[model samples]
Each structure stands twice: as structure tokens, then as C-alpha cells.
Target: MDEQGDPMPGATVKVKGNEGNGVLIGTVTGPDGKFSLNVPDRKVMLEVSFVGYVSRLIAASDTVSLKKVVLKEELKNIEEVVVTGYQRIDRKLFTGAAAVIKAEDAMVEGAIDVSRMLQGKAAGVQIQNVSGTFGASPKMRVRGASSINGNQKPLWVVDGLVLEDVVEVSADDLSSGDSETLISSAIAGLNADDIESFQILKDASATALYGARAMNGVVVI
Candidate 1:
């Protein structure tokens, strides 16, 4: 479970062995945030990991066997060092127009999906809700209005890899008010609380690294 006691589905659980490079067993949490595994040793090390949350290592003991474990949110400060995907630089030495929104700061109550979270969080970044359906993604613009239609979308990046839209649909259909077509999004199925932070690049020097794909600007998560 997360700090808020929310069930974390699909969280990975691993059993660590002694010494180096040893993995005994592994499993994932279910929808109810419960997992079970039989280990070879009575006392084993368990590592729980979920995206954007701090990982925890626990000792498998009789007392804690059936108890619930909580994973805290990862609060990382980017003022010390700046990891801009392509390179690493000191924050003071780096000069670029970038805005960061921490998960805790931008979170809305009862909001598992973040399509509306970025609405007014970052500067120069505009977000419009294309659909009101559950898990639907919002339309986003880094500098300009979403008036050009959905001809293109801002590049989606996680860690250092780029993500492509899974569903291919035209802007005309999306704005047609049809509920089915409006239920499209890249991170719709993702839990907003799992995100650590959002880095918005609003300047040329900051977005030049992505070339044409980032012509609209860059959003790093």
C-alpha cells in the first residue's frame, strides 16, 4: 500500500538471496494489494518496488508475514543536480526555462488519474480536457494553445525513453463528443500517485535535445 493507504496494484515484490546477484523469488501485488510467496529459507529479505515511490526492504518474520506494508512517496529535490535526460549538470550552473511539479504538490484529492492535475501546475504549459470519461487523457500544450487540433502531441518521456500514443485517432473524432473515442490516453491506466515529478522545458536550449519531436516543447517525467 502507499502512504495514503491506497492499494498499489502491480507492485513488484522480490526475495533477495545472500551475497551478490542472487534472486530467490519474485511476485506482484494484486488489486487488493496482497501477495503471497513461499521461500526456501525461514528468514529472507523482501524488496518491494513501485514506480515513483520509495522502495522498501523488509525481513520476512512471523510477526510481519501477514501484516500490511506501506510504501512512501519519493520526494526528490531537483535544485541540487539537474538530470535533463541527455546530460547531467549542476542546477546553479544550468540555465534553462524548466518547471517542475512534484506529485505531492500537484495531487488532487480522490484523483487517481492526473489528466486534470497538470491543468494549472506548470507555467506556459496549457492542459485541456479532451474527454470527461474515466481514465481519458487530457490535451496538453507547452507554449501554444491546443487550437491547432490534435495533429500532434507533445512527446512523452519516462526516465529517458519516449512513449508513443497507443491509440491512433484523429482530432476531429476526439472532439466529436463521442464518449468512446474520448476515452484515450497514454497514462490513463497509470496511477497518478505513482508519479514522482514532472519537468516542463519551455525554452529552446532546454528542448533542443529532442529536436523536431520537441518543437512544441518538452515534458520530462
Candidate 2:
């Protein structure tokens, strides 16, 4: 359904689960704006996307069946406020390589964590889902790696509090098993429901405010 309660057609429906690692099933809505997908019995995320509207994510359980869904049309020219290091500024006045993802926009279907929400959303930002274990977080690099010996992960700040990157992986862990043991990111502790928005700073112009600490990049939440 559309925001006006009218039936919509041609909307995309995708299902993702651990078995698929990504999209397991993809289909389009019928002429009456109804869709039925046969997904695996395991836990999955259902993504509904339509052009000119905001996409919605719905988590699915074994017994879950979607009865109704609505898509809201996009609003243009709405000013957005973003956090740039120590200050909040209007997005129009900011001049730098940065991207902002609101909570609604970040919540994609099949996303297990916040880092997964950022995959391919930002231009210079790269997100690699290296681990499939429970409670694991993906590896993120901003504007590529800058230092050989230093940490390559982006700095994460939640509600003005800087978070520490605690990823540690031994070389032996990679070669010894079919599935490499990946260290979870400290940001994995955050609750996705509590996050309002996230701003990623990619270039020096946007990250200089944090100095050396943001050499890799900055993810301000």
C-alpha cells in the first residue's frame, strides 16, 4: 500500500537469511500490490522497496507472514541536521565528503547489525561482512586504508562518546579453519533501536576536526 492507502504495484520484495548470506528470494508485487514469497524456515529479513518511496525492513520468524505493508513517498528539499565531530551543522552548509544515514534508512531487511546497514550506502566507505558468527560485526574502512601499522577501522562515536575499536585477529586463526575467526567490533554493543542517525566522514576536510584519531575515517552516531 502507498501512504495514501492505495494499492501499489511493481514493488520489490527480497528475502535474506544466513543460508543465503544475502538475498535468497527476490520478486515483484502483483498488479494488486500483493506478494507472497516462499522463504526458508530459518530466521530471515524481508525487504520491501519501491522507487520514489522509502524502503522498509521487516524481520521474519519461522511463523511470520506479512499481512500488510505500506511505503511512504520521498520528500524532497527537506533540510537535515548532521553532526560533524564536535558540532551540529545544517547539511547544506557542510562542504566535505560525508554521508548521512537515518535510522529508518539504515534499517534494511536481513541486516544483522548496524555495520551491515552501511554496506554500499556511502561512496568512499567500504563494509566487509567478514564474520557470520553470532554477535560479530563487519569490518569497515573509510576512504581506504591509510596506515600500514595503525588501525584501519573507522572511529565510531555514539551520542558524542567515542568508542574503542577492539578488533584483534591472529594470523593463525585465518589459515587454521574454513571459517576465519573474526573479532567483533566494539560498536556491536550498540542497540540499533537507540541509534537516531549516523554520519560518515570520508575526506580530510570532514575528518580533520578529529585530528589523528580520524585518519581512517569517522562514523558519528
Candidate 3:
């Protein structure tokens, strides 16, 4: 099951050695996120993994017949996984203009908004607060505007959910304001503390996945 208690279809379930190496038996979860495997005589570990979620390894027991497993959404430590448009690649092998801002660097003491956290952090990205009001969001542009007929704002993605249009988050879900930090519409409703990291994708090579919607650029969080 996923963190939402919904069925996590297509989750990989593999049997590994005690040391977390060598696959013994491998299968995938069904529509209900359930699986059954015939255990071997020796002690072994069960490894389960899914996209957009953290992988887990657990001890397998022949005596047990049923096991309930849940996969949590990955919120941090994505240094190895670099999301480049439609696909994910290794950070070392990516050949695009993708700049990564680690979680620790963005979660500063007084950082209350994504604009403040990203200010002066990424290259070719400009952030300026237009209003001084308590809830005024800043104006952000990646490599300046790319289109005159459409929006010039960069597309924002949080935990794989893209926000190209207006966002409708509950007011009660927002964090308390420390003065005015109204920044951008795509990122205005986000909580800084909950963000794991920020990946600014510039250049046409990095923004090609979204087609015309990514003409300005993209920010994967």
C-alpha cells in the first residue's frame, strides 16, 4: 500500500540475501498491493520499491503467511535521482543545465518562502518581490520570459505533481507569515519546511519534456 492507504499497483517485490545483495525471488504487487511468495529454507530479506516512493527491505519469514507493507513518499535525499523532464537520470550523467539546491541549504533559519530560499542560489534564475505586503509573492523568471503569447513563469512541480495553472490550497494549510513573502503563484502555497530540495531546469535541453508549457523553464521539487 502507499502512504495514502491506497493500493500501490506495480510495486516491485524482490527477495534478497541477508546482506541486501543478490536477488533470489522477484515479483510485482497486484492491483491491491498484495503479493505472495514461496520462501526458501534459509533466512532472506524482502525488498520492495516503487517510483516516487522510497524503497524498503525487510526480513522474510517462512512462518508468516501474510505481510502488510506500505511505501512512503520520498521527501528527501534525491541526490541520486535527477528528474529531467519526463525521465529520471543520475545526477552525474545528466548533460542538461539542471542546478540542484539541497534541502539543508534552502531550509535556512528565516527562510519562509520558496522565493527567499531560491534567491541568488541558482544561475540564470531571477527572483524579485514585487509587493512589500505581508502576503505579496515575488516575481520569478528563469532566463527571463520565453513567450509573449503565454505565461512567462516557470512551471513548478512538487513531489511529481505539476502546477501549471492556478493552485487551490486551503488557507489553514499555509504556514504563518513572517512579514510578507508573496512570491509566485506556482509556489506561493508551498511550505518551505516541507520541501526536500529544488532543481532548476534551464536551457532547451532540460525543458524539452514539457514542450511549449516549459518555454520559460521548470522547477522540480
Candidate 4:
């Protein structure tokens, strides 16, 4: 039975002897939350347990007619941290196309940097290798370039602050792999342990928050 006087079916009733180790003598309660067990002619222990409720231990008399028991419900609340943008908002309240990748989930065994680890981590976001070299900074694009001679990188934001400092690489620089191949991404300076998650916002909602600078999209870390 529960604390509310309601019958709790399927509760386990065990007739454990003096030593309660390796004993499997137990039975589940009936529909009316009642159980009967046959034990030796000696004082033993009765262990009552149920899921989502506290377990109870009672002394079983050497005679018959055992006492009734009641169980109590256990309630719990959980808060999961999954950042999406500048502020935390419920999924039902936010109308944006966003993908969040946890640092622990995106870590690769032999990945040299965070940029390669982010490859294929989000939808409609491309993280391509600028060169075949191991230390070359990868190119990331949320969408196709809007202009031929304009800034083509996605907007970078770290903890609600826009980061304007970035190494600009032209198409020719990428082909020859000489000018910016050794230059690391701005995110490379950040400690991977300090990074919680990467949130990529890819729609009008991104531009609405940062204006034309976010026309390409937003990468919030």
C-alpha cells in the first residue's frame, strides 16, 4: 500500500532469514496489495520493496499473521544544460533552427583541433579543410557566400559577445595553402575543457539578433 492508502500491486515481499545475502524467497503483492509467505519456525526478517518508493525492513514474528505495510512515492526534478544561443529559452518558446553539440560528444580520439571535431556536427553548416596539412585552419560556412568580395565566415559569438577578430583567407590563399595555413582559428585559443557546447543557429533568427553581420548565420559557443 502507498502512503495515500492506495493499494500498490507488484510490491516485493521477501522472507529473508537471519543472514540476508543471496536469499531469493520473495513474492509480489496481489491486486489488493496482500501477500502470504511460508517461512521456517524461527524469527526472520521481512524485506518489502517497490520501485520509486523507499524500501522497508520489518521483523517477522516466529508465529503467523504478519503486519501490513505502506510505501511512499519519491519525486525528483532534473535540470539539463543545453545552450542554444545568448540566453536560455525553452524549446517550445524558441522558433529557430539550431543544433547544439556538447564538447564531450564532439571530441575525437585523434582530432588535432576543435574545427575538425565540428565537421558534420550541425545541419546546413559546413566545416571543410582549407588544406591537406594537419594544422591548417578549417573553413566554416553556414550558407553560401552572399557576396564575392565580402566577409564569408560565419558570425562568431562566445558567451553573448561578438568576436570580430578573425583571420581572413582569400580563395587564392586557400589554393596555395601558404598565407593563412599556419594561422589558427580564433576558437583554437580557447581551452577545450572550458568549452561546454557549440550552438549553430542557421536561419532568420540568427540575423534578427546580430543584424547584417549575422547574415551568414551564427556560431555561439
Best-fitting candidate, scored by lDDT:
2
Model 2 has an lDDT value of 0.74
Candidate 4 C-alpha lDDT tens digits along 115-210: 677887777788877677766667778876667877677887888888764566665576577845556355656666777878788876677689
lDDT against the true structure, per candidate, is 0.72, 0.74, 0.70, 0.72
User: Model 3: per-residue lDDT, tens digit, 1-221?
Assistant: 87677988899877765335453577888887887776674477778899878988777763352366778898765446677757877788788888888877766675545666788888889887555456555567886865555556677878777875354322222233434233335666778878777888887765457677677778989
Task: Flag the better candidate by TM-score, 3 or 4.
Answer: 4
Whole-structure CA lDDT of model 1: 0.72
Q: Compare candidates 1 and 4 on TM-score and give the better one.
A: 4
| Candidate 2 C-alpha lDDT tens digits along 1-221 | 99788888899988754434653587899999988788775466888899779988787663343667878898666468778867776788777778988888888876777888888777878887654566566667886867666567777888777887554543233233333243446576677888888899887775557677787788998
| Candidate with better lDDT, 3 vs 4 | 4
- Deviation (Å) of 163 in candidate 2: 0.3
How far out, in Å, is residue 35 in model 2?
A: 68
In model 2, which runs have C-alpha deviations exceeding 4 angstroms? 1-78, 167-183
Instruction: State TM-scores per candidate.
Output: 0.56, 0.56, 0.53, 0.57
Residue 150, candidate 4: alpha-carbon lDDT: 77
